[model samples]
Target: MVHAFDFTAPDSYILNCSTLLTELPVLERAQAAKDAGFDQVEFWWPFDGNPTPTSAEVDEFITSLENAGVELKGLNFWAGNMAGGDRGMVSVIGAEDDFAANVAIVVEIGRRTGCRAFNALYGLRTEGQDPSGQDSTAAANLDLAARAVAEIDGTVLVEPVSGAEGYPLKRYADAAEVVAKVRSEGPANIAVLADFFHMSVNGDDVAAVIEVEAANFGHIQIADAEGRGAPGTGSLPLRDWIDRAYALGYTGQVALEYKQDRATAFDWLSHVTQTA
Candidate 1:
């Protein structure tokens, strides 16, 4: 199998800016990455902070990409819909009127950028609800998500926040079940985003876990196990993921999405960038 290797970039993979679209202006950020020899990066909520940078901004962002020789890989949709939504992972189907209204804002962002991936939220659970009710409600919320993004032209990702309760998907299989069930319905737009740090926090078995959802797996976010910092900062057996990706015929972005406890995670990225 052919590995992505030099085929992928990581400069934009950082979540360094306190808020989306902040920090260096989009153009400057792209230029910096190009100067540093990176070909790929991502924008969190590119719509926030600034009035949607005009075509002028898109022009600049694109220009930076051309100059820096970088690719705008993907945009993670973080429109506050999931922020206070009970640690995330509910089905937005049952959200209060305000909740649905809130998510619409995120949907608008996806539409504007034509983003392919988005995180679905299901505000806090309904108090004093039963198991069957909860399951049905969750299912409804998943349906609502699929419907909301039906015209989004991209994929809507479902991620189970690490360290959360009941939704304990310490492994990919557990997570896959959630994805699979959601997709079992019509129009398979729902996919799973594997986050290594959270898996580590739950003491999950990555090898067996990832295989379960290998197919449904769309994007990946990883970092050292400690402090949610960049790789090389901790002792998480990360290479195993590379090995698994190759062996499983996986072809997706291994996004180095993590917090910048210091600068970016460019330390050992050179070798890995060429090999990615």
Candidate 2:
């Protein structure tokens, strides 16, 4: 049952509570993650559709992490109503102000939590709006985000998501392209978020991407392809991909963002952590 990678390292992986622990309330997920043996956790926008949540809400969030003794390693900027079909506000034409507002909040959160990585999901293509315009808006917002986070020594991440129709960034290269564009414009802190499940589902050569773009990765997330479950639940070389990324000099935490029962979602880690 020995695995090639060491899953016992304290900083090696981050449990993505946003996707994994669905049964628990948002505030409780941090403690749940800690109880599950993770010292770090990442989350999507916790505020329900509100770009600017009250200070009390923010305080509660930080307190939860503190109470659980789990570090907030990564977080998403307010991507508009994810459950209602809005993927992100970054590229939405009229949502520029909201995105800018969210950036400030995210920066403050990063300052308080020592979290340096922030994922900015690119919004889906609008029905009649010009794609070029949306791209421009996205670039502008990304630049703004990068600059805002830079004050906290933070990084802005662009990720390719799957199962999200109209989501423009579906492949590693697609997200990388956006990253390249934003980075070129003077925000050096921007990078691509390599989500293996999304890339694999979108038909990207995940291994090749790791080999070539490891240096450009700000963070790495994984879930088995086809089912978006735990490491061993679907067909993906999760261990090899992770080992390869580490060998290629990528040192960021690997986020486990998958949908599965809490009881068995992390069962694979038990085997991986076992010594021969």
lDDT of each: 0.56, 0.88
Give per-residue CA lDDT, model 1, range 80-107, as digits (tens).
3323334343432334343344346546
Clashing pairs in 1: 4-276, 5-275, 5-276, 12-41, 12-42, 34-68, 90-122, 93-141, 172-209
Best-fitting candidate, measured by TM-score?
2
Model 2 has an lDDT value of 0.88
State which candidate has the highest lDDT.
2
In model 2, which runs have C-alpha deviations exceeding 4 angstroms? 1-5, 8-11, 271-276
| Candidate 1 total steric clashes | 9
Query: lDDT per residue, candidate 2, 171-260, as tens digits?
Result: 988998998998888989999999999999999999999889876688899889779988878899988988888888786778989899
